[model samples]
Target: MKPWLLLGRAQPPGGGAELLLYQRDSEFSLKADNQELMNSRVYGSEEAMARLGCQNLGKRPGARVLIGGLGMGYSVRTALDTLGEDARVVVAELVPEVAEWNRGVLAELAGRPLDDRRTELHETDVAELIMAARGDYDAILLDVDNGAEAMVREGNNWLYSLPGLTAAHGALRRGGVLAVWSAVPQPAFVKRLRRAGFGVDEVKVRAHGRSSRKGGAHHVVWVAKRG
Candidate 1:
């Protein structure tokens, strides 16, 4: 068996913990506080998050999307592939080193999504972008932390709160979608999404890609639409 090599380490701005990057041959992993946050080998849910969030976008030439996390860049790449040529994808990654890793050692894992002309990188908190916008994005996808539980930072809980959900609601255009990826199901958060005036749907996806015949762990993707 191959050993995982430590590639790089980064500290999230304002987060108490450090994020570690590791590689084993072609596979990669991003972890925080010893907890695996994302892995190169398991990205089916991440891809599904973007696909479900942007399903309504189709080939819309002017569609604009915002991705909250840049883990391995799978969500952004999937979104770029789903949207039209003129579509714009704004990626907000709180950790600078995560973005740097995507450009360096981890670039090929997700096909160098940052190099894509349509992507606009923001080395800031996704909450700031969500709160500052008004009907700006056609879809907002969040893959931050460990879902509503806030594994990396306690402040991340705000992203799942009523106020944060309201901000996200206002950030989206009419009929826009907000998709959130979580390692586990969050039933209470689903109620909050409805309370924030979004029509919500909870989707369960396999951890491995759809092409995988072998079954594996399941993840949750909450698709909430702003009506």
Candidate 2:
């Protein structure tokens, strides 16, 4: 086994926790405050998030999708796989270095999904994108901060807040889906989704894959649809 090398550090906008990039052999990881934010090894739930969200979309022509986090580009790439070529994916990342990392060190790990012409990279907050667009996107996927509870950035809370849920609801077109990834179950957040006018469905997925890992750890993906 090779040792993990620290690539670089990036701070989230508004002075939140600093994200550290590490690489070991062929794998890459992003960590913050001693917590593992994302790793290249485990991305099944992320892929599932995009799959279920787009699958619920039901073949909308020229579909436009917004992905909240780039994290190894798993969600974005899986979304591209599920949606047709006409589909456009807008990825909003809070840290600029994350985009660069995706284009650089983490490029091959995610098969360079950002390089695709159908994808647009936004070096800004996802919440801003959600607030700016009204009924524009067919699907919105959030793969941020250890799930909705968030252990990385403070501002991320708004994405799972009541007002944030309302904004996400407002940002989607009729029949659009809002998908969120979390490492643990959040019953309160489920109720919040309902209050935001979304028909919610909670799916349990393993971090490694569809089944529980050796420690019985599983992740939750909330697929909420509007109208």
lDDT measured at residue 93 in model 2 versus the true structure, 0 to 100: 90
The residue-by-residue lDDT of candidate 1 on 93-121, one tens digit each, is 99999998989988888889999999999
C-alpha lDDT of residue 84 in model 2 = 82
Could you give candidate 2's per-residue lDDT for residues 63-162 as a string of tens digits? 9999988978999988988888788999999899999999998898768999899999999999999999999999999987887876778888999999
Measured by TM-score, the strongest candidate is 1
Candidate 2: regions farther than 4 A off: 56-58, 210-216
Output the lDDT of residue 220, model 2: 89
TM-score, per-candidate, Cα-based = 0.97, 0.95
